[model samples]
Target: MSIKKEILKTIGDLLMEKLKNLPDGLPDLMWFDKQMGQFVPPETDDTAGGTPEAGISLPLPAVLMEYEPFAWQTTGGNTQKGSGNLKFTIYCEHLADSFPGSPVRDLALQHFDFVAAVHQVLQGLQIENVMSPLTRVLDEEDLAPDGVVFSVISYNTTIFDHSTSRTRNHVMVTNPGLEVKYKEESSRPVPAVEIPAFLT
Candidate 1:
């Protein structure tokens, strides 16, 4: 697989493994796309299934991952180095009823817990073919329709491209022999040096 795909899959697997056992239950993980039709919540079966859903479906929460275009520069012969940002968007339904007596009070601000857990799993993470450990570069939150709250978190890392590198074949010479001839003895070339024996 391509390096980009491998890196993304690795990240997703790590997050899935780490976040699967949270008290609130595991959240769905998906790759982000420009067309978000697939992310829309499915229609409810009520009213003969004609009514569209007001909000996205849950696992209560979900995460979408994507990466920014890489900025690249030639590092040396046939190799280029690049830096880019990887972003994760976490979506959750906002719960305003976290009053002291509410039974679901623990879930009122549960998105923060998910954010923290994501950071813990990803911060300083190192992956093969990547030059630097992942580091958080930005974090922001926004409100969506139907009480959905989403947080976008970004991390920066460096990677290298070696696709342009050429394969080279090398030959090794061992115990080479040398010949020498004196000016007066031009007719005869005598063995004057043997590499390993001469050095000894």
Candidate 2:
């Protein structure tokens, strides 16, 4: 296999292995979300003359690019802060069901603390030169409910020049989707309601 393919395979293997170690239900749910209507095959039809059949139909534009976390040290000069930065991605259909109300999306963020280990192992779990995975998601601008496609990205910080602060930002530049979630959201306070003093 090509070098890139091999590396990607290795990462995938690690992700699967790490996912296996997750608390049972969590991993299953992730898998379920990933598997939902995600593939589209080429169009074909019954043919006798070896000629074209009917009109062409567009396939669903959906995909899932998941990565297992990994880290490698200063292997050498050519490597230069190599592997200091890591990245993970997820591509899928961003259906109306896959947003805030979707448990899978919510749970994925929740499990990052545990699932993150999959990548940390690359650096022996030291976490000295690591950054949170960059996570970027893409979908339709107007965002239709049924067939909108989406993607997710998570990036690890890089330790360039041996300094920790100059890290690569996660969610590498891109226009985000209509929906977003923050880890600190749960900690945010709800707006207070005011009642007429006379009603009291």
Candidate 3:
């Protein structure tokens, strides 16, 4: 598979494995595909003062959002290996449980714990022999319309830069000759024979 596809596949699989056992009867693992514009979370109308349905079965609390390839550089002259920066976003809702008035410290702790869990899952992650150390970018909090908090993490991972090496392989074939070796018991001596230019 291509480097980008491989990287994403590895991350998606890893995250699913780590977060498979979330408590609170949260929704199953969900993915937000940027190209497809799918997997919008429930309670999205909350920002518009519309209360989410009380008993509606919404999608999972955790979602894998879009990833951006920010920067890339060649590790050496070879195109086989390089490094690049990939920013990934993960959104989760119900960060804290509210009382009659407001949320308690447990909410904050839950959010912190989720972030720590994701960090632990991504640290020193390897995909297809490429190593990545996931680092969080301390950007301003991005709350979705449904009140889901989004976290941006940067993955600076090694990539296999695929490039056609036609320029390196093309060479001028000028002279072609065949070298022959004979044993001592051979009856005939080795002779030089002219080879066709096209054979070069």
Candidate 4:
């Protein structure tokens, strides 16, 4: 598999392993967070205010690309230069037990653990390896306006940023939580992913 797919696959598998005991399987091979809860509105519409329905289940968050161009320089008479793209993707998810949402500190811990594990795996590889869990952002303040705070960035520049000199690249591993502003996958029923009843 290409580095992109390989990295994603590793993360998806590891997440499932962490919550291996949870039922309701993932739809295909997706990175899932089963322990977390979904966000909900405080007020409801009814004769009076009614209780909100159950929280929405979520899919494995995707790390969208954040691209940057590498600068190059030449010592020729014309002083030529070149540019290459440095691509990044950050994936994250957050939970809301109450109005504001789940505590940020708790999720930060998960982020750290995930990062450490991923880093270890990446460093141990022989061939050019892919990082797992992506890169995590620990600060609640770093979140996007919508609410996503924590994130993991898994990226490869080899394809976009080719080099003639010796390639020097480092792996950055992570898995930080992020708040969700978008809607859930409620309309399309979550597929039946059955686990052994005995485990449940």
Best by lDDT: 1
For model 1, give the RMSD to the true fold.
11.2
In model 2, the runs with Cα more than 4 Å from the true position are: 29-63, 66-144, 147-151, 154-200
Better of 2 and 3 by lDDT: 3
For model 4, what is the C-alpha lDDT against the true structure? Answer: 0.36
Winner by TM-score between candidate 4 and candidate 1: 1
Q: Candidate 1 on 31-146: residue-level lDDT in tens?
A: 33222333444453343212123455544466677777889897666677789988877766675666799887777667778778778888999876655799999998774444
Model 4 segments beyond 4 Å from truth?
Answer: 1-58, 65-67, 71-87, 96-108, 121-141, 144-147, 152-200
> Lowest-scoring 10 consecutive residues by lDDT in candidate 2?
47-56
Q: In lDDT terms, how accurate is model 1?
A: 0.67
CA error at residue 2 for candidate 3, angstroms: 1.3
- For every candidate, C-alpha RMSD to the true structure in Å: 11.2, 28.0, 12.0, 31.3
TM, every model: 0.64, 0.29, 0.54, 0.29
Q: Model 3: residues >4 Å from true position, as ranges?
A: 22-58, 70-78, 95-105, 137-140, 143-146, 162-200
* Model 2: per-residue Cα lDDT at residue 62: 17
- The list of candidate 1 runs beyond 4 A from truth reads 23-54, 57-60, 95-103, 168-200
In model 1, the Cα lDDT at residue 178 comes to 55
Worst 10 residues of 4 by lDDT: 132-141
Model 4 earns a TM-score of 0.29
